[model samples]
Target: METCSLPRRKLAAPLLALLTTLSLPTPASSAEIHSYTLPQQAYSGSRERHYKVYVPSAMTTPAPMVMALHGCKQTNDDVLNDWGMKAAADRYGFILVAPFITSYDGLRNENCWGFWFEQHIHQGAGEVEDLHQIAQQVDAAYSIDPNRRFITGLSSGGAMSMAAAVAHNDYWAAAAPASGLPYSEDSSSVSLSGQCPGSATFHAVSQVVSDLTGEVDNGYPIPLLLLQNKNDCTVLQTAANNMRDAHLQVFGSGDFKTAATTKASDTSCSPYNQNNYSCHRIAYTQDGTTATRSLVETIFYDGPLTTPNAQDTDHGHYWVGGAEGNNGKWALQIGPSYPDIIWDFFSRHSRNGSQPQGHPVIVLQGDNPLTAELNSAFSDPGATANDLEDGSLNVSADCSAVNTQAAGSYSCLYSATDSDNNSTTATRVVNVVDSNSPVASCQKISASPYAHIGAGRAYVGGVSSLRAYANGDNVDIGGSFDTWSSVALYEGETGKWYSQLPAACSGTGGGFVCQNWNTTNLNHVTAGRAYYGYYTVGGNQYLGSLPGVNSWVKETASGYFQAGQCSN
Candidate 1:
């Protein structure tokens, strides 16, 4: 953690009041600001350190201490500007501390947290000792609650926080790491010592996590609140998943399977089920972008830190230190609402091998994308399956509120779990599209397989084809037939009704046999009725008409013509 303390530059009365109101509360009404000097030892020599502290005014007795660690290439003052842990301490009424790392080049200017474990803390013994000394000094100076001490950080600071949990587990009640992972690094020039809080050392948090579940090899699972972003380009989301899985592999005893899932564009989470500890992973995926935020909440079945379930702060830098978030830096900060959620989780948990309260758990969608409806169940011991496996839990969710946009009734059926060790057995279904009437086209047709036919003449009957093509729509052929009554016949040469046709030409010139003199009607004749009526099938049309007579003959005034005919 970086340590330079930011001065209390007074603000406008109104603005100061507003900021003060925004602070999380303590029993006291005001928070005090103070600074301390710490001594540290380096591979080459020794040095002194500095850090800032904020004490809630309402706390008469020892109040909880929360240490905030800064990220890499950042200073304590820089973190203060980016991460607003001080404001959170004032509002929440908890003691806040920010420690600084020292440089070994005798400059004391290139500040950095010394190695987390004694292995490195020894090389720079003064720096680690300075941190411990400051804590002791504060313990003596005020009502500092030793049992309720907590540590949290981001990036490199986050890794250091893990080290702190391993190296100083007795000093902190819980640990929260944002966008960070366990150390697997070897010694390097930049980092003089092997990782701090190495696997060889297991503190209270890790020991309790291991003891409850039964894993001994991995770094102990401290009472932890893990947050990561699925879409984070810098830190891979897989690391967070691995951490959650390790917990379940050691503790879970029932039938639940872990699942990878997302709800919107901003985040995502992995699945884990074990006795006492239930994995709550959140992923935000909006549009095509992956959500860069993840939250890991752990609870003890028994002990002073037992809670039904833990709530976590958002992980996206966009929402960090905003009115509703925790962790991260950039344009958007964690919100004011974040502190409460963090405290709620921490207050209910400890790495003491205690049984979780087994509180009835409910899952609800937050403002983020990876959300499911509230599910009620008892977190039981052992491995537990998804809620869908039991056919009792409803993981249907509405994703319309994501990205602060008004989405139209979109929902999803997802997998989930409860405390009872049961699994989801059925699929949940939801509808998101509209059910309004379809759009209209320029034309319409009969139900199915329908066609128009030509009215039969007095001596002939035939079928007429009607084919209409409409834009943006299709016509149905309902296998039914109707007749067209608009056909009229007239003599092409005489200007009169010429109801006759030319007979076979084998005889004198061309024997006339009631020739079809209606030029207009004859000109309109073509091919089959279904087609455009242009081609002739062997010099004749397939009009359902009587045979044995001159083909193209107009019907008499009685409305009958002579042509080929078929079955009724």
Candidate 2:
């Protein structure tokens, strides 16, 4: 319901859900730059606002919008150009809105986003509220995609972006705060607001969110890509660390899980620095869900130093690595392609409830992890499809690609479409596996139970300890007793093979005495693979398998049988 234009949002879309690979029609961009202004509020000394918008050349209808906020002493025009965001806009087809700060205290003569002002910190009040209104007005003019709206900025711009996200958490799809500070109880105080490593002074993301939207919870946790330059002098690494901790204080506990990736070291990135400042990415996502709505991902770029912004003396502080990347001011050119990264992260998410969902449904009619005997003929179980607009639909299954003659996993993809060209696809894995093979050996031995022996050993289940060694070997099992378990020294009358112990074995290990007729002899057998049991006579021994799936040593081998091959 919290959309760019609530009137045309959900009702405008047909029953077509967003396709995994959507083929949306491209719209011609107006290529016109437009500017707007909003008179300051009745507040004592609030200044009027100025902002600009640029629609990409080949933008998508209801396109996404990115609010490019500038750092201290920098104007919106500088951010749109010097940060290489305008070029990104041209390439990605999103509406770019650059917000300029007009208010200046008596002391400071530089343009800066008022992230720490008491009025700006709260939603629907000051500078932050003005930025929000600009977003709404841009959508009113261009019909922007409500689900894809985004906000990102440099130093102070970044801090303001964080505030904007918390204040209007339901409005933005994602926010990337570069070298920005987290919300603090002392954020209103200019001196204390500059404190780093919010561990001691920062407020929990939940707390500020609660403060901003009291009794109005959207339940949509804002996804964030916290950016930092490891070599940044203006904003120390502690600030980034504290920012991370504050978000984690709320997202770290429950369904969210943390995963890490190492940085890539490339020496050919920027002329300024000769080291690869590949992003050290730490992503946190909810359990059972991936590819979208990330709780937080902290990226540390340790690249070469570059020119500083006019307001500060910090290098490696700007957005890095774009086709037209700017390193003149608060920009770094050697690190990761931030534009592409931001777009990719932004594309994965949308406002939680804003997604239109009358899409056609196609559900496969069979077991998910299905299986067939090795080299056996298989048939597609097929699927049923239905749509809200088109009603019941004919479903087509692409099962010709499934090769049952080969052992391993294949998929049967089922797809369906509504009258409106809205379509969906479903897939089921068809695992072809080998039938259980016998674990026969050369001779019979102990009858005592050994816990180490597992499945596939079941292939020779019909054979008993009392049975003579008939493995094509002429050796006769010498039993002066009634049975191997009941009586004597189980030695072979013909061969010297015998049990190492005088006790009786009751389970599958009893078959180990027989010769193992395997692939070396016949071509119908499959190799057992990937760990079921570590059989050691005493302790610590050797074992082998194929790898990936097929734990033939397990008792329930048929159930977990996957990722295996059947061939000579």
TM-score for all predictions? 0.40, 0.51
Error of 2 at 504 (Å): 88
- lDDT string for model 2 (322-412, tens) is 4456544566544465665566556556675343334565544444556878777797766767553455689978877778788788888
lDDT of 1 by residue, 519-547 (tens): 22213232121111222222233433211
In candidate 1 the C-alpha lDDT for residue 346 amounts to: 56
State the displacement of the C-alpha of residue 339, model 2, in Å, after optimal TM-score superposition.
1.4
TM-score of 1: 0.40
